[model samples]
Target: MEPLVQDGEAVAIEQEAPGDVAARDMLLDRAMGPRWRKKTSQKIRQGRRPADGLAFVARSADGGLAATVRLWNIEAGIDPFGRPVPALLLGPLAIDPALKGCGVGAALMRHAIAEAARLGHGAVLLVGDAPYYERFGFTCAKTGAIALPGPVERERFLAVELVEGWLDGAAGMVVPTGRYVTKSRVRATAIAA
Candidate 1:
């Protein structure tokens, strides 16, 4: 199918076709850096489809997967001090080496964020360089009540609340959907009330 073209650039975002299995693997294998490759591979092995959680891919002029991103369910917001909120988590954002600096990553991010907002997601969270993500309106997750499944530096864990005041008085850990359910310390025994 033809790509979604705009701003003098020929691009497309669409449902991944069955014929894309090989292409998808290739992109995933190279685009994700070392820190994320293992987790990404595990997800693939578990038979997760990009579309299962709003994964959208950016294709190049040649119809190649230049970039891809997935929106997973994550809890974010305030602490018991009154600042936790739930938000869709965006992560493992990857860009094809050849397509780097060509705006593929940016396009994918914009599209994903827009889609999440359209779906009524209260917010979006991710771990990444603050400088790079700041341009997209993401800020260091204040309220500090959330933690990842594993160790993560504070500064890099950022988020963008879709509704301005959505996270104003909420608190909780941001856990992967189904991976944690207590609404408390996802890795421990904390709970939200």
Candidate 2:
């Protein structure tokens, strides 16, 4: 991916390198607070890696991390017609507090979605502010029947079809396809060792 120019400087958007994990988690904690760890979105993303080519970061002109976003594989459960829907989930999009209104965050969103589509993904789902995400073509119209594994603001559930009509009848519980290991299970394993 090419770096985007912002204010006469280059804002590079690139695949998140392994070394970026600590910085990325710190950035998200600052932007989203400690409660961010307990959200329904976090539950689904708990032990998962972002889909191939879908985890990205934006570095500012000074080479400081500026923003980040990731897309994960999820199952929209079985619809009324008994068809299972496979989709991508977007979340934890965080921008540096100092550069909140800068276009970096928006650019990340655009790039992430476009990359997902380019990779042949059919649909994307997210729990976010409808007003803010509507600009990206995410709407609650097709998400009325979808529920997150944990409690979430119903109104914040939204979806966008990467392929035309991909979300038409996607209804069910939003479940993570990733292997989720509970914290207690980890403790139990440690005790048995």
Candidate 3:
């Protein structure tokens, strides 16, 4: 992705690299508070690698992580025919406190969604402020029948279909289906225990 200039500061949106782990965690903690780890969204992302090419980070001109977003592979319950419905789960989009209004977050959102569609994904689901995410086409319209593994505000569960009607009739509890990180790989990357 190309670099974006927000308020005279050049910000680059790029793939989340291995070296970005620590900075990404710190930024997430600061933006979402320590309790963020306990959120239902975290449950679906735990121990999984992000959907291929779907993790992104925004960096300021100084090379500091400014914002981040990732999508994970998930089973959005089942369709009317009882087949597992595949979808992408997007979440924990965090921005540096100082850059909240600088368009960094929006840039990352657009980049992530576009990348997901380009990669042939069918739909994206997320738990977030409807008003904020709606501008990006996220809505509770197709999510009424969808449920997370844990409690989530009904109004906050949303979805945006990349392929029209991809989520039609999707229902039940959303669960993680992304590739799991092996213990050795986790230790080597220091991403988790």
Candidate 3 per-residue lDDT, tens place, 1-193, comes to 5789999989999999978877888898899888888999999898899999999999998999999999999999899999999999998899999999888999899999999999999999999999999999999999998889898999999999999999999999999999998887678656441
Better model by TM-score: candidate 1 vs candidate 2 = 2
Query: What RMSD, rounded to one decimal, does every model reach?
Result: 8.6, 4.4, 1.5
Candidate 2 per-residue C-alpha lDDT over 24-84 given as tens digits, one digit per residue, 9 for 90 to 100? 8788878888788799899888766677778999998787788999999998767568888
Candidate 2 vs candidate 3: which has greater TM-score? 3
Candidate number with the higher lDDT (1 or 2): 2
User: Candidate 3: misplaced stretches above 4 Å?
Assistant: 188-193
Q: What is the lDDT of every predicted structure here? A: 0.65, 0.84, 0.92
lDDT of 1 by residue, 58-100 (tens): 7767777777777776556454565435567676777778667
Per-candidate TM-score against the hidden true structure = 0.73, 0.88, 0.96
TM-score of 3: 0.96
On TM-score, the stronger of 1 and 3 is 3
